[model samples]
Target: MTTNNNTLLCWHSKRAGVEVLVEAIKCLKNRRVLINRAIVLVQTDTDSSLYLNHEFGDIGLRFITASLENPANHNEIYQRLETSVLPELKDVANLHINVSPGTPAMHAVWLILHARGHFPSGTKLWSSQFNPDTKRTSISSVDFNVNTYLAEISAISNSEGSYALYGVDPKSAARREALATLKEFAQVPKAPLLVLGERGTGKTRLIESVVGIVKQKKVVTLACGGLDSQVVDSMLFGHVKGAFTGAETQRSGLLREAEGKVLFLDEIQDLPTSVQRKLVRVLQDNHHYYRSVGSDKEETSDFELVCASNKTIKELATTLDADFFDRISMLTITIPPLRICREDLLDDWQKIWGEVNVNPSLPKHAPTSRQLNKLLESSSLAGNLRDLKKLAFITCAYMNSYSPTEALSKAICSLQAFDDIEENEGTKFSFGDLSNTTKDELDKLFKYELARAAKRQFGTWSNAGKNLQVDQKTLQKYMKNDS
Candidate 1:
């Protein structure tokens, strides 16, 4: 849909400054930007927005306002924006969300919109930047070059299917692809789905979202870890009253409960061989051959099966029956770890940290791109998405207690130094000036850390070497020498 008019949506935060909004519009105009629709979300107060509305009107940009009570509430903002914009996204030529004026949380929600495919394709993002050195405010378009991310926009619903990508770096191309695949499967749920990934790589989130997206009425999620074979059997296929030593009462099985709905088995690899065989029959034959403990009556239940494991389908094939592997390989979606795909993290979380506002020092000033990137690149964040989020909050906590006045730039520098030392020494180290730290020593330490990380991530040295394309022997030699 081509409109002579463009749309600009913005968030009005507590720190909304009239000058910032004015200069943003002026910059938009100076750049010959034509805008006819402007929707501003107001949360803090209306005084600045009154002037913002007037400025937008003066430029012939028809401005509208939505209210947000808490800018830091990511979920609320996400739902509100998604619900408000879906109907009109097609009609808008260029959807521009001004990032210059809202809480970081609000901005993060905006980024979520982009990450989640809520923004219509071809949308333009406008942002206001502050250059501390020059002490100037400037309006500009952010490089929202995520067209590849929008490849499956046609199959997309305005739901949170892409939520697993929430706050994730857009540069995480592989993860985005996995999200799209999951969404596609949810839309037309077919054969059994096998989600494969590293631990904490979000396999569980994908299955849960699938159930949500499909709107399954009756759902049964079973954790297949440390489960006794008999206990799992009793849990999956309800035991009769006094069915076993612990079965004091009759109960229905999860399979029976989830009939015609969804049955998500997290950590499916933990399923015992006998249990796995029974599950295979349910999927392959449309019938389950199972009896409750101390009961001969076999029961059956048909359900939409979604299984997750922190291992590859190929690796799982060795442990799982070949027939089961053949049966479930129909729809296997794998998620890559965060380290491999970390492009957009710096941009996404800088806004989130800004929104949190708990870091009083952060509210007074925005961090330079360099500071944000340094945090994103820190070796300390090896725990994937989960760890990064924790590190961000932890860093905020540290800022509040130890260095409330610390500029984000300086804080990031210290964090980098801390991680650097820890990484090199293979031990916990405190932050301090490493003035006399020699390049040779630092090099040795980095090599040791890299080798350790490589082994941890890739498992065997040979495997790591294959990925790194260095001979295993040579790689080990460098690591052993620590040079």
Candidate 2:
């Protein structure tokens, strides 16, 4: 593959100047690697690229200005390469990335990008080393394996500190194993990855962290739940000006917006079968492309597809189109629910507490460790991370106005009462099984508790109403009845 290398891509080092690039070119030439074009990343504030361009202009030199004074800014560097560099090199089949120049951070970014499969299949990463004994520089391809690298670093990332980076506390063996699986899956950049987890099991958070590493841009997300066939099709494949009745001007769609990034389809099992068939073709192979709703010309978008569902693969198979399900099931990750990893409850509670305390919109109040521990032990966390966070928010609200002891007391009682209502939510309540008066009391109690929980979850009554699917007046009525 190196024999067909027509592009020499590298970053210009300030200290080494153009010597590193020149040495790499010489070594490539010696190795019979044809360099028809040289793409160099130079500092935006420097004229060094002009001089280097003057010297290498005959070799089709192209300069990409990078504001990389602080080479440690990996996000900026990765974005620049994704938006500017990679697009330019898409046509270069056998590209070579010279890692001889730039800072240590820059070199790491290249390896990460390559290991994560951001580079094309035939791309080579070359490293040049100077041999003092021979008074010459030799070039060699870095033999880095993505799976092997992930294995070597698994030990380091298995700790609580690393998991905390993703706003999760994987304290149990099951959670640690799940995280390891996720890290390995992240190495396969383009393969469609499916995440299976119950509600409030942190599936979205896990995807965010994994996608953050593989792709440095924000994920483009579309919730497929409750969306009809036409809506899903127009959203994913976009539409021309007159494609649909109310498409307005033109819609580029989530798939187009997700080019060079990750597209997370939440609750993917809910996607209509008609749209699922269309996606099978878009996700099949290297030549995958999609046609817009009203256009015949095929359009291409290069993106990583990540799907998530609360249902298991078996459940998904029953509902999804066979081919579409098979295509997206290329890689799967299952996250154990909080019930299985109950040991993480306290840690998860603390993390939520810390976030609530720091939130600028919430009244800042610190609770004693003893109070927090007492509250955690007394409250029910069976609802998973969501319930634990809600408990923390409610406790924080109490602490803002009440004594620490009183806040703990109120929080425990509230959670226990809420848990009772939730536990009995689906049971039959005929007059023989339960009196009308008792049923009315439970209904009223459940409504008040739900209203209060919503208020705590969302800072304002308006937001609470919108999220709870109730009108502001209804929520106000519930609050008034409670008072």
Candidate 3:
């Protein structure tokens, strides 16, 4: 039999201990089967996961926490697998399933999914057995023809909505259209792509979904914000040994590493002008060849480019070079902010809160449905998804001690309190605005707004402090605690 490196998917057996999983992986390794990664479904606590990671983390062992109510029930197991396990298979290649560690019902669902055309077309199934008397572990293929079972069992319908797999609302027309555009763009290869959205709009997540749809094997990413110009150039294009003052060894940069895969550049608007000029040349070339910073030799990398920015198109045009902007705009995806898509905020809040409050035994730390609706109706979420998530975190932390409605209201008030002040409002203040606010909180807000307005008007901390007759350090302190 011929075998190659592939991703292994299996369940961790509680009865037999993770030793069974370790030995099974060892058996495959001995057979010269290069299992590059494993997705182990674990039902127990984090200790077992830690043990597995300690053992085979070099080979990329990953765990999925699947807390099943009835492990033996087919329906329950199938639903759990569909929701959690299937989403992770987006970028998987040459998938191999180990069927030895799970229950008979669990094993049956694996085969059912195979017969129902759920797994990738060429997925292989393997089983391992441990001999008690001989104390030896053996492996073999579970090579039953799924086609034979297909005649007896009806195929499952593809009833899952396109956005349903991504935890997005199917009822949202704007989101549905954006997803459709992404799906169409994923099929076209080697075109530069641009993703535009406000902060916390999940631009990276949307791109990952596209990569999964195309089944790309590798993804390399870098956030271009706040990086020095020379450092960003060397990091993207690589450098030879002794290329700079601190260089002791040669470096293979992100472009070379992302060969034949996806390269994601986040905060592209912050990339320096010099690097943008070089990158524009690389994109315009037919072969995409460029020289390293110090090397005379020219090299080539044919990787797909995906760039994201939190700025609008108009803002990006002002920040980025015109040629660079035109090249990356070959394909574009824009994520709508949460304020316009308010209907989606409910689902987003529930998901974010559920993630924050992971312990099921803890009392529910959520507002009543009516109270939540009223809170959303009154709040202005300028930070979009970020603000909604922050509200969830605040509610989860304070709801146990305070009334849920009060917790949510306080969270909204805190978020809405920090808006840019108007010129006329600087002269007049309202006591109504200070009703629920403490004196200390009001003082902090006052300092924060004053410092920001001064900085904006004067364009420097020293000038602002001199003009306001305040110490520079005190202005900086106020800005630090404004968070």
Candidate 4:
């Protein structure tokens, strides 16, 4: 049978496989039309072969088969597609390659083609049947829809409002106060806003809730961490066709996508220096222009920018260019960490536990008076609300396997294990466990807990110091002094 290497085949027999293939095809078709003819690469299995023959045969689609009994034979099939097939389709504009669910040979073929850059530039690769129930799909490169997935997950996991903010009372005062503020904020004339907090402090949840409150606005979220300068620039500012490498078509960036809406940026501190400068320009002038990939024309767009970060603005300013910091307005709201509001643990626990899928018969165990006192007194929460939720989940799992008393005992044992490990490794002493602390010395206690938690999580002073939101040199100084 004749095959085209530039034409990729997606092979799947079941519903889940087909769904993934459809989604993948949708993503590709939205970008460009494939005309060189494509095939669904299927195995020699009965179901797949029959499906291909009966269901897709009339469509004039091609089917390439490789032996499933011996995965090693896939190399031969790959050679045929690469050497014999792709050469024939060289004249086809926008030659592309894709593969469906099949043997290891299919994946190998893709990897070889990708390494050799044989596929068309800007080609989006996908894996089929990643999670059928969740309707989850994986794309090789980041796309606008990736933010949509993050927003969807955040919405689903948090819809039940199971976790309470740190500083709020669950039922009466705190809940009422927070909700009142949120409602008021929603009613205000829409403008650029900023949410500031330490890592894992539920800033995203608060921002999402606010977005929901502002019903008329579209929310486009972006994480600025670990992205390349060029990608970040293109993502925030629409790029024209041929603007850069792999830019096959003109595309609107998030700023344009979120016009007359909210552009929520997470980890704003990680935005590159050049992008930061551009953003500053946008904020100050309320208008900015972006050059298309290969076009000479520049497009101007406007939008509301909402930025969130774990780093303090002062600290971020030190790392970023002055012009960027100058453009960011001083209106900021800080979300307190979980340890500050130990009184709301029960409400938070109940809220989160209700949303989790668990055995219905599992008994709900509220913390005992003594346990509450101990938890309130302890300060080992390294990751704020995120850590607390994880602890709650672990506690719930343990409760399923044992009685409340037993589960509490297990938790105590784990906390003690943390202590034992620190002692064995000659880590610094914890101030909370120390005696005779005056009011003036209480701040030192908080610092000790922060440092200890950072060290435990990172296993080294330097990394732990980063988590503690301090410099490595300062952490070394603290370690050397051994207060």
Candidate scoring better on lDDT of 2 and 4: 2
- The lDDT of each candidate is 0.62, 0.72, 0.71, 0.57
Off by over 4 Å in 4: 1-190, 287-295, 363-369, 415-483
Candidate 3 error regions (>4 Å): 1-169, 212-215, 363-368, 403-406, 417-483
Worst 10 residues of 2 by lDDT: 151-160
- Error (Å) of candidate 1 at residue 252 is 0.9
Ten residues in sequence with the least summed lDDT for candidate 3 = 151-160
Sort order, TM-score high to low: 1, 3, 2, 4
Task: Give lDDT tens digits, candidate 3, residues 279-351.
Answer: 9888986478887889999899988888999998889888899999999988888877655455566656754
The TM-score that candidate 2 achieves is 0.53
> Candidate 4, after superposition: displacement of residue 472 in Å?
23
On residues 238-286, what C-alpha lDDT tens digit does candidate 4 reach at each position?
6887777898888878877877777789888888988887676576656
Candidate topping lDDT: 2
Provide the RMSD of all predictions against the true structure, rounded to 1 decimal: 14.2, 18.1, 16.6, 21.3
Score residue 252 of candidate 4 by CA lDDT.
78
Candidate 2 Cα misplacement greater than 4 A, ranges:
1-169, 359-382, 428-483
Q: RMSD in Å for candidate 1, one decimal?
A: 14.2
- Give the per-residue lDDT of model 2 (tens digit) for 231-282: 9988998989988888678888888998888889999989999999999899
How should the candidates be ordered by lDDT, best one leading? 2, 3, 1, 4
